[model samples]
Target: MDESWASTIAQVVSQEYPAAMHHVQHGPGHADPRELHPAFWGSYDWHSCVHMLCSAVKLHGRDSDLGLSALLDQRLTPYNIAAEADYLREHPLYERPYGWAWAMQLVKVCRDTRWEDALAPLEAQLEHNIAAWLRTQQWPVRHGVHSNSALALLLIFDASPRMRPLVERTALDWFGAERAYPHEWEVSGHDFVSNGLAEAALMRRVLPESEFDAWLQDFFAPEAYTFYTAPIQVNDPEDGQQAHLIGLMLTRAWLLREIGKPDGTQQLIDAAAAHLTGTNFMATHWLITYALLAEDALGN
Candidate 1:
């Protein structure tokens, strides 16, 4: 939220435009990510790059910082973003729900910014793709990982009221029946999001307050959810796989705030803050976006 954090995020999202490109080149001619995805070819992957760009839009909208403004102007141009849309059109299910969700969030956050028009092409593409996916996909990917449907739908639910009805219907059908979550079985080593927590967070947005309270009680089974009371620790921050747990702490903090678990939110935020020092590229490449999410949700 400060100039220092802005600088760090700018550095991470822009530093390696062509490095670590995670593209599944399906019968490709040229495998270069910069030419392929000129707008979102950074921050390791498409979704991370998108959410970080979302952060840029939000920061610029808030403070009108000249650096962030310049970044937005450079990357969020109609020419570059339409190229991103063109790429997505070629690969319809490229990022599927996760990256699509962040793409929508990016546009949603850019509503009042100057970049809104630039993102519209991609936004329209995602609208058609995600809507079709929501209607046809019968199952939710209820994992604490990139493919998780609940968290992505949760992001979509917040990104627009136009998509809310579809998101709510699909979310209820997929996750409404979930109960008796085995809290201990949650959070695989490389997971950054908690499947159980993301489901609850989505349901909270869809269900009424009293219904959600009852659903929460049934989902956790009286007192089985103390696992998240403390922040998850990453034993090896340098390991790319283990580094995901750093994001887990930050995401859990915001979702905790969403589900009215204030007692644990501070603990998670405090524990996750130490890793945002810009020292570890494994953590810094994408964790600041989630840290900003926690900071906003906690009103800090």
Candidate 2:
């Protein structure tokens, strides 16, 4: 990641916490978002806050001189983390599979450090919640957004090796037989993740190399190659909904790289970068998470 990007991510993660109450306020005590989700009360929403925090930690490593260390040290305290877990406990289904998955990814990157211990309480809660939910989560959400099951499984597969069996079984059960996904008209108006490519990314992790290759060959029509291999154009930059298209570019680049097709990856990333030209909170708060994924995949 660039030095400027490190600064931008740190700033957004530290500030821009959800300005208003988003979740259902069950009681009178939890009024402020900061009070509601102490450790993860920033970046517009819980899930975005969690992943942006992860991006900050990943970019600014152990001895990084950036303000991220101090910010993390302060927010990732035991008290704050415990409050976050408590929030999850109270609202059992809050953030559901999407937020839970990103929270695990945050913990995955923070492992082997003090951040891990700070997040231990939340991690335990997530493990318990996800285990119970997976058994009942029989249907796969094929949307190109937060509810999508493929992206959640991909994150779980990447973050927690202990959950590999569940992840594999869930993936194969849901998407193993995928063939003939109509690629010409796959994405929607407001999408941050490509549903088809997201499934491909997860399948690459769960299936063997030979099997994945064969599955890849059969998953999409020839039109998908052309559609996915190019960058998406954003007509409006300031609109948050349109920003979802910008985020999709970075996500597709990373997922493509993950599935072993690096062609046009840089073009996709660069095109996304060109539109990230302003300080619009609409795109700033969560875009870095996708940007980090793109950078990491390209780097590897």
lDDT of every model, 2 decimals: 0.82, 0.83
> Which RMSD does model 1 reach against the true structure?
1.8
Q: Residue by residue across 1-300, what tens digits does model 1's lDDT show? A: 468667876887776643665567658476776787788877777788889888877777668753887777788899999998988887888888889999999999999767888889988999888988877887888778889998899999999888999899887888788888888787687999988888998999999999999999899864544678667768899897898898888888888778887675777778878777567877777888888887787662
Q: Looking at model 2, which ten-residue stretch has the lowest summed lDDT?
A: 13-22
Number of backbone clashes in candidate 2: 0
TM-score of each: 0.94, 0.94
Judged by whole-model lDDT over C-alpha atoms, candidate 2 comes out at 0.83
- Index of the highest-lDDT prediction: 2
lDDT of 2 by residue, 1-300 (tens): 456667776767667444533588656764667777788876778888888888778876734876688877877899998988888887878888899999999899999878888898988898888888898987999888889889998998899888889889989999999898877676799998998999999999999999999999999766686698687888987787889999998998999888888887888888888554347877887887887787778765
For candidate 2, the per-residue lDDT at 110 reads 92
Give me the runs in candidate 2 sitting further than 4 Å from their true place. 17-21, 27-30
